[model samples]
Target: MFDLIVLSVFNGLIYGLLLFMLSSGLTLIFSMMGVLNFAHASVYMAGAYFAYSLTPYLGFWGALIAAPFLAGLVGAAVERFGLRHVHGHGHVAELLFTFGLAYLIEEFVHLVWGRNPLDQRPPPLLDFPLFTFAGIDFPAFKVFMIVVALGMFVALWLILTRTRIGLIVQAALTHPHTVGNLGHDVPTVFTLVFATGSALAGLAGVMGGIHLVTNPGMAQALGPIVFVVIVVGGLGSLAGALIASILIGLLQTFAIAVDASLADFLRLFGLQVTRATPGWEVWSITLAQIGPMLPYLLLVLMLMLRPRGLLGSRDS
Candidate 1:
């Protein structure tokens, strides 16, 4: 029992960190630019594909370094040529544009990569087991994911709170004219923020393509969860996003790890429901079956109890 729980904790940490890698980028875009980029996950998918395509030419290491940068450049171009044109039309327009862009990006991926999931395995250098705990071996690749996520989190916090460029980026949305008067280009800042956010997503993709699945449906699978993380953490709060990511990650891990069913849950309280009992159909279900739906459930509960999220400000 203890071993199962321990294993679950480790799994939860890895899952949570992965969520952070994706959510942090979304959070940065939202908090800095005030744009709810619907295509963020699509960009992440593009990054994964970008890395995959580059691997043959550059090898895994080169692709890993280059793909995110390429993704960033693509993001900058989108903001400059596509999104900026729609910026004048208000948030609804921005949302619609990005939402459409997401579909377009998905179709493009499908047309180019086909519907099959890529055979994107972890690089040979990091494929071995790093350690064993609770009789389960943890992979080095997953440990790398954890380290990268943590390093990015710390680095982002420092850059945002302690750096001059961070100050300018943060202020650009709230005080554009003021920033412009100070000799900074507000539009350029917005482009940089979008690119940076996309780059973060791309970075996540480079690792996540292997950590998770790399497929055409990859963006659709994760897009909603990223939004959930951001909303649960707070609309524009990076710290909130991180906390929510871990919470959701742990919640999901435990749900899938536990062997208890609704029937077992009742038996724990000396109550047993047989096949003839009322709602047997429901009671027969196991928590592992509920794993996929847990995040949305938490999302609903979060909205009801505290709509702003775990660490969101009242105004946010």
Candidate 2:
């Protein structure tokens, strides 16, 4: 039991960190532009498909390098042509535009990749188990995920805090008008930031595709969970997003790891019911069964109790 718990926690950390990689850019984009990018996860899906396509020709490492670059370039084009024209329509319109784009991208992906799950796997070098604890093995690919996520986090932190461009971005987040008055190309910064954020999402998609599954519906499946992370972490606060991601990650992991029931807890309290009541479903009350919904449960509770999220200043 203890080993199971430990492994679950490790898995949670891995999952959480992957989520942060995707959410950090999302939070930044939201903070700077006040645009909730509905197509962000679609961009991530695109990365996975791109990587899948490149793996045969370029190999895994090459695909890792090239896929995100392609995604970022696509992002820049979207911003330069699609979003720039819609900027005048207010945040709601911008959001709707992205939402429509998401649907279109999904159709495009289906048309291009076919409506099926790809047989994607990690490179041969990363195919084996990394380590074992209490007879449970951890895969090398999962370790690779942790390494990549940490690298991205460190690089992003450095670029955002230690660079002159980072300073300008910080300024633009708060005072775009002032940054513009200072003779910096604020729109250009916006474009770069948007592209960078999309690239990060694409990277997450690529890595996650190997660890998780890559399919026509993968984006639709993961998109809501990513949104939950951003909302629960707090809008525009990377730190909050990080914390929320870990919390949700651990929550789901542990929830699935431990299989128990509300009835079991009630029995311990000497309040067990003798029979199943009408409309009662055994699986409905099982922790493992409801594990998938844990994140959404936390999302609703967090929004109700702390609308500003763990680190957010803005109204959630």
Question: What tens digits encode model 2's per-residue C-alpha lDDT throughout 154-213?
Answer: 887788789999889878876789999999999999999889988988898889888788
Candidate 2: misplaced stretches above 4 Å? 276-284
- CA lDDT scores, all candidates in order: 0.86, 0.86
**Against the true structure, candidate 1 has what lDDT?**
0.86
lDDT: worst 10-residue window of model 1: 307-316
In model 2, how large is the Cα lDDT of residue 237? 73
For model 1, the stretches where C-alpha displacement exceeds 4 angstroms are: 173-183, 314-316
Q: Give the TM-scores of the predictions, in the order they appear.
A: 0.94, 0.94
lDDT of residue 80 for candidate 1: 97
List of clashing residue pairs for candidate 1: none
